[model samples]
Target: MTKHFTMGGTATFDFIELLGGYIVAMTGDFDGGAFARVVGEPRVQGNKTYLDMEHTFIRKDGSTIQTRDQSVLTAVEGEARLLGATTYNVVKTTGAFEGLTGQFRSWGSVDPATGQGVLRFWGSIGEASAKAA
Candidate 1:
């Protein structure tokens, strides 16, 4: 049997000069605080620019649910010609359990007037088996 868990969180991005990347730290009420660091290389593939990223997440409670994630980000035009949206395809791998893998999709767009962006993502785990399982 497969058991599923869903979590929603907000992240803050900090640019690191030495590393030449952004460090994202996210915290949520649902399961305490979770931290993730992402590093990426930017490349222009054809007409679109792409970011190849590698990241990891660890829970504050010292649980073994740490995961290594890879994501690709792309830009798109919204219904209005002036509006733009960004989308991501995220893949994750973890050792917390046997066959622990997850795939997630997310999208973000800024409110033109306020300049604030909203990001949302959902993830699903597949055929996971923990020691307890």
Candidate 2:
């Protein structure tokens, strides 16, 4: 069986220059007090933008759950917003998150100017074996 989760958070990013794109280190605070950190690269080519990122969720005890996801980001014409949808796959787990494996379909937006934004995620998680079926 799968278990569902819904989380919303506000995130901030610090960007670094890259040849073909930009890299960011992101930090956030989630509704349930969980902390999030991410390392991502956003590339702009022609009229398209893409993101490759890894997300880390930290618990109070300092253990973490990690996921990797990739998606395309679309800029809202005449607005400063960019929206994206992606599936985050569990890549690592620890402590209370041990054996946790699943994917989360996440939707979010970020403002390039301030490097700040809000994100909401809703998805189901299950064992690796269970999901294979």
Candidate 3:
């Protein structure tokens, strides 16, 4: 079995138009001395836009983990906000996280007006695993 931590914090993403469509990039810091870079596609519907993002979390020493996230963007209280969820799998690692393999789920939202957001993730790591429901 693996230990589970209730994890989340703040993040930000920026979007730009590409020849094919649009790609959104992200950067954020989690609670555990980790920061991440995310890349994804942004699709606009009638009233909402959604993003499917892939994230790589890197610690200061260079250890990393990856996650895939899907989120929707909309106007909330006069500010652009994002709400989404992600299914994460440890794709690579180093240091204390070497040999780490497992999965987890994360859901969160961001307020563009403030360039900040809140996120929450849960799952098991080390010798265990899980599937999102």
Candidate 4:
């Protein structure tokens, strides 16, 4: 059996928009290092918006882990917040993170006027071979 590991951290980034999506760069203890880029595509509904985001976690050693996240953005007290789920796949890992797969959940909110936000994510990670046959 593979060992289970939990990871999470806090980060801040600017909510930069581009081409129907947003490109965010984050710092401050993201998993192991910083999340270099987060590309988000949004689909809006009446009062809620759905976001498809790609998160790149770059470790201090330059290794990386890539995750696909799905989130719902809703208004809370007139501010925007996101709650979502994530998937970590072996195919998306680089260097030291290879052969690992897992799932995670994330939540955060942004300040529209300043275009800055704080984000957090936490979840368990395990080796791909741990899956049952």
Candidate 5:
């Protein structure tokens, strides 16, 4: 049977450089601070831009989940805020999540200056085997 679940979190990013790309970091109260990092290359097309990224979610217990995430970010209504829709898949898991596999679909928004963002995501899991990929 497929185990379904939902997750919500907050995220932030730091600009390393244009050529070097950026590092996006996120965390939440799930499993005592489930922190995640995303590294991606940003590209623009027309009035929208997207980032093809690799994300890793690490829990305090040392369990980890990795995914290849694709996000489309657009400036919201002529404001300084940017909204995003991210779709990711579970590529790997380790430690406590060794046998786990799952994916997540999330929506987020960020501030250009502070890089802080609000995140909300939900998806289904395979079965110790869990969700939040």
Candidate 6:
């Protein structure tokens, strides 16, 4: 049997002058690590330009987890790489459990005609895996 989990959130990226890089802040229902920050260099492989980042997520319960993320704005023609993994505390809210850790992986590609980038992700929190649901 396959269980589905769905999380929606928005992320903002800002360039850090002193850090000489960028930081991403996220927020929303299925999102934490709003304050989580990463520092790394950006590189391009084929048509994909990505930033490899290292950051930490601190949950409302005060537990923390480290993460390494690689965000690609584009993919080479038709290819995907294992970006990274995440394991962090999940807060219990009105609808869900208060604290848990989850793992997620993401992939991205660009439209050949429009050049628009698209990203798709899959994640698991506990034994439940998340799809479009």
* Top-lDDT candidate index: 5
- Per-residue lDDT of candidate 3, residues 5-34 (tens digit): 323444444333242322223233333333
Q: lDDT, candidate 1, residue 116?
A: 36
Q: Report the C-alpha displacement of residue 69, candidate 2, in angstroms.
A: 1.0
RMSD per model, one decimal: 6.3, 5.4, 6.6, 4.0, 5.5, 9.5
Stretches of candidate 4 above 4 Å error? 1-4, 16-41, 80-91, 130-133
Compose the digit string of candidate 1's lDDT tens values, residues 1-133: 6755454555544445576444545555324333333446556554345444444445455433444454444444553211222232334534443355555444454333433344554555455457763
In model 4, the Cα lDDT at residue 92 comes to: 79
TM-score against native, each model: 0.52, 0.65, 0.53, 0.69, 0.69, 0.43
Candidate ranking (lDDT, best to worst): 5, 4, 2, 3, 6, 1
Poorest 10 consecutive residues of model 6 by lDDT? 85-94
For candidate 3, give the lDDT of residue 29.
Answer: 38
Q: List the residue pairs that clash in candidate 2.
A: none
- Give the runs in model 6 whose Cα sits over 4 Å from its true position: 1-7, 30-43, 75-102, 105-122, 127-133
In terms of lDDT, model 1 sits at: 0.44
The model with the greater lDDT, 3 or 6, is: 3
lDDT (Cα atoms) of all candidates against the true structure: 0.44, 0.59, 0.54, 0.59, 0.65, 0.45
Give the distance in Å from residue 13's predicted Cα in candidate 2 to where it truly belongs: 6.5
How close to the true structure is residue 63 of candidate 3, measured as C-alpha lDDT?
58
For model 1 the local lDDT of residue 93 reads 36
Error of 4 at 6 (Å): 2.3
The TM-score measured for candidate 5 stands at 0.69
Q: Kindly give the stretch of ten consecutive residues in candidate 3 with the minimal lDDT sum.
A: 17-26
**Candidate 3 TM-score, true structure as reference:** 0.53
lDDT by residue (tens digit), candidate 4, 1-133: 6654566666666644553334455444443543333355568886667766666777777777777766666655544544333443323777666666777665677665656667776666767674467
